[model samples]
Target: MRKWVFLCLLFLPFLSLAAEREIRIGLIDTFDQDFYLETFVPTIEHIQKTLKDYKITVIELQQHNLLANVVKERPDFLVSSAGNFVTLISKLGAQQIATVSRNHAYSPKEAVSSVFIVRNDRKDLQKITDLKGRVLSATEPHDFDGMLVGMGEIAARGFDPDTFFSKTLFSHYQYPDVATYVKVGAADVGILGTCQYEKLLTTGQIQPGEFRVLEAKNNTEACIRSTERYPDTVFYALDTAPIDEVKAVSLSLLSMPKGEFDFEWVPASGFLKVYDLMKSLKLGPYEHLRETTVKDFILSHQKELLLAALLLCAILVHVVRVNWLVNRRTEELKFALAVQRATERKARENRQKLDLLEKSRVISQMSSIFAHEVKQPITNLIYYASALSLLLQQLGVKDDRVEYALKQMNSQAKRTSDIVEHVRSYAKHKANRSEVFNLVEVIRRAINSINKEEIEGVQTTANLPQEAIAVGDSFEIELAVLNVLKNALKAAKNSLNPQTSVSVTAQKHMWKITITDNGPKISEEIFSALGRPTSTSKKDGLGVGLSIVLSIIENNGGHLTFRRIEPNGIAVDLFVKKKEE
Candidate 1:
């Protein structure tokens, strides 16, 4: 037993050593090893600092033959363009650790893009399809953003990118060279990447509006791109890479600051957009989708297709049954709707008849009230007229009595006329037409209409603004205010020290007429029945005042409310819509 335990302990060190993964990073060759290394020096230094114990080695691989070398070497980390990363991910289950950010561009997830350019003088090529049979000048064909991305855009628009252009011209990785070719009329259209045209304009090699963009994407304001953006260069982790080591590298890259490259390292974004583009152009991971045979697809999807066929049959049966049920229900609902509409029509006619009967009752009641009320005024006017006639017969005896008699007769005549007009309007139950009237003036008229002796003998105060414009029927508002003031005066008459105050205030969207008095607290029954017809606290009350006030105010987008004052008082708030300043 001791011997076996010793052997097991001795192999533990070897097992730990075998578990450790190699920290090797593969960098796709861009310009040269030195240039690429310098560009990503900050990232390299950061990784070295983070994984101090591990020996990190970066290998530069040629872009054209990276796939073979990548599979053979099985690199733990691969820093390459999004297209290469996507290919590696598809082939070897590679996962991107971080995306490279760029200066003066969209986020790292949506930075790489390509554009189609033409000289401003090329009026013949107004659109992208115009360059279909024309010569296309572009940078290196192997370059992802400069050439391949533009080709993907063409494919996405349903064009065969392989045969879209009659002839192709290469500018050999110089983005500006393609623009130069277009400017010199060597090619009908040129393709560029990474705002090369805008850079040239900044260098004064191209003027504003000197080149036109074809099928330009408004995806960004930083550059004019013809194609949708994919993610920026990514730091990727292979399937064989150790999870702990990959996490360390990711942390180091993300924490690194922008150095000479003027770009930052950020967490990798989803590459579904890149995958979709590659699928459309038959590139990268989706290359096999284009190569699959029809027979292979049928064999692989036979079960799904069979299930789909069964589902379709079941769906057809369900649809037929549902259609029959819906038709029958629709007919039954139609009959019910017809019966309901007929019932509604009968109810509406009955309502009209009720309204007519109510109006007739109002007319008869108002006629009787008018006749009873106008008799006193008419009798007084006759007496005053007889007195005036007597005074006129006695000539030269000019006294104040003659003038008094004439004024009394005129006053009683006016009263009689007002009563007649009011009863007619009340019996008809016709609403007054609304208009913009000064509320200050309406309140003044209401206060003046009361008996002068009663108002002066009591402690009544009127505080109103100089101008308060309201929107409502002026006559209705005046009547409402007058009736309320009359009630307040009557209630305060018997008080030891009667106090009544009428004030008009202008609110944001409403004109408020507040009538308050030191009278008895309103009864709950009277308060509840407020604004309702045939409800009154006074023995001789007609109950028309508050109802008319509420109805008119409500109809004109206003409100009426009553609040009980502390101790022993009642406050009335009449709100009407104030004209906007």
Candidate 2:
């Protein structure tokens, strides 16, 4: 009985806390301070000291997920890291009331930055490109402000961090790891937080003279030290958040105690700049969501408008005069038919042009692959011919043996020549044509033609059925599938090692075949671009591969879609209707 009573007494504080009106404050996990004592507990302590009416709870989230969770939580207020706050204000309509300057390195005008560092002894490392194919070390992959921006600076200097870097080594342990990774030669280049590196050098944890900073211009934003300064945290409520609560919370944060923590509240920043950044960088989820929402709205309204117009025409036709109405109806029907035909014809022509453009884009992307593929066969031909010439120059060479050797060498050269021609022909044929052929067989032939021996950088596996057939231009389907396969292959190859493989699985159901890939995912921007001619990646692609694929599928009464895989990668589902039994 005594034990039960004690347990009930212990639960009283939790019950009272739960009963109070909840005010959520979002925090980022990047803040190294202990939340139990620093932000959350202190804030709650302040609330108890100041506001007697409400109960406030602090929720810590990563920088990337913080804004999204805030939108979901519909938080009354948010108190997050300075850098993350800037990101929110720039992208979302979040406002800032107070900025908490960490006493360690916080100042009125200085901000922290992750600087690029490399070993001083390494040769051939003057420019950014010198770090190509070298191991890059970062504290965390998703440390956007710390690592991403620093890398972006490198990319701005003409080296694409994603493709140019050979290996990425992530050490989430902080400055010590960054210094150690560089000192021990584990990483070719290391990114370190501004003060962290200085602290390490001061503490004798790392030798300052052992590392060199890449010569680049630097700037400051808010208090953050950045190569290219981005604004510090701003607090504001989003569209769905309650304004009164936000204002109240903002006021509360501004009135916070100075003894425990030194921070000030400021007005919320505009997202137009952030939107512009997103457009410029093509990073983040906002622009893609906006685009998807707009497209969906347009499509839905178009369908409704068409249906309503058709209904109005049918209902109003009975009120007009008989002969006059007949002539008017005839003209109207002709006009409608003509419009329909014109729309379809334009769509078809646009699709054809898109196809040709995609083929060229794919060819351009695979130039290195082509060069790599051609090198071996050409090298073999040269080596063998040189050996044959040397053999002929030897004394007492039999005529019959010489003839046989010549015949063999000629056959090998012709085979190599044929491989080159096949690759060239596939890339060169851009015109659209409609001729029925076995789609399954065409896929097999494409697989066979993949130059598996010469270009071993990509691994491709296709699970196509033996007897599946569809009546469409075989060449077009081959090209479309080839492009997708190549894309998947490249994505895998780029992100991972050269041994990465792309799996293509074809699922045949009642009148449909779905081709899927287990490769790096297609983002929303690329997925939403299906059948649209204007979408493209910056790799000089005309955004025509899927457009042409969609066109071909539509022509054959089929559909193409990009489905998101749960764990990773993307499934480029090409739904083609089966021929009649």
Candidate 3:
């Protein structure tokens, strides 16, 4: 009974601790439990003191069992480096609450870096390139600052450390082992965490002159580092953690006093730099991701890729050449078109000038002809009037001869007026006054205009329709008929036993008039030029009558044609449209 009571009393404290509500935090055993205990125990004690209802427990986890431990234990919170937290946060639903900020010797921000070191007496390992075929040592393959950052720095300098160095020595947890390896000549170069390098210096384990940092970057914090910096550590909560407890622990950590741990909790910084390093080296959480080796892929498809490249180059060259040719041809065509337009414009201007000159010449010639034609009639009128005055004085206005002379004077005066009117009508280039009228009446009117003396020797016969109506300029058509009749009369007078006939016929939508004369057949050359101005067969002809008649017929949309009659006569056909279709 006494031994049982003693064992029960001894187990009381442990049982009480287990019974209390506790918040568990998981940490990776990066160094050792003692190191973490020394580093974080005070912060845990501070949190426990603040939260009286909850106790704090720290669980150290190995790397290989970290994901399993987190899933099985489901700790309330976790403590890890930024690189490890990145992997856990992605895979295990961990949320970062705060990042551990330290007053690092090499960085003013909460960051860590890697330093590459070589023995001072080794002159051959002066630069990173000198490490080719040399032995390299580091803490661990996945150590963010010790190995990954160091290799990333070498890669940034265009060197692949994996193939550049002959061998790589992994020291696992002891970063100091990397330094020792270099000092013992096991490695030509060493990569170590900047923190560890500084710690070794402070403890006098390695003198300042024994090893030198390679590619040391100068910073205001005066840290001896060769690689870019990354965030130091992070505190996060798992997805299954109690929300209230996570908040309380985060608040306590943020407000904790600066203790022996020398760490301050601040808002979490971006961990993308660590993520980028992992992705570059394919380490840690990124180890399972596959990557293509560019050298191998290029070598395997060299012929196909080369052919594709050559075809692409050829196509590009052809496109460029075709574009140049098209532009050149377009410019040439534009120039030719411009020249053609200019030439056409010049020809139009020349034609207008020629038309104006022709009009002026026609006006001058018609004026001269008009004056000559009227002069003879005026002189005859004056002579007859003088003769009438003498007879009236001698016979006291009673003689028939005096009356006859007065009539002759009146006739001569009328002839002069008609000549002047005819010349005036030709001078004015007026549009025809059109109306509906009978075609037979128009022909009779045209025949009445001809002088009886001119056709006295020719026998004239008219074959007409009683009611042939047409739509046109009646006066213009009358003049055209008169011109045709006068030509036929002249031709008939020249023939033996001269005879002339006028015939009219109506057909679909048109009136056809034929005037025939037993006259000489016209020569083809003269017939071709029959309607041209200044072309005539008669010696004293003004040569404009047929042309004027042709113009009148054309303006009324009618046609005039002359053909030789059978054996020895001429036939003139005039066609005009009926008013009603």
Question: Per-residue lDDT of 100-137 in model 3, one digit per residue for the tens?
Answer: 67665333234778888999888877777777789999
Model 2 alpha-carbon drift over 4 Å, by segment: 1-20, 33-48, 62-74, 81-93, 101-110, 127-129, 174-176, 216-226, 234-241, 260-263, 268-281, 285-581
Highest lDDT scorer:
1
lDDT tens digits, residue span 191-218, model 1: 8776776877889987898888887776
TM-score of each: 0.45, 0.40, 0.45
lDDT of all the models against the reference? 0.78, 0.60, 0.78
Which rank order by TM-score, best down to worst? Answer: 3, 1, 2
Q: In angstroms, give how far residue 418 of model 3 lies from its true place.
A: 99
Relative to the unseen true structure, what is the C-alpha lDDT of residue 91 in candidate 1, on a scale of 0 to 100?
79
Write down the TM-score for model 1.
Answer: 0.45
Worst 10 residues of 1 by lDDT: 30-39
Cα lDDT over the full model 2: 0.60
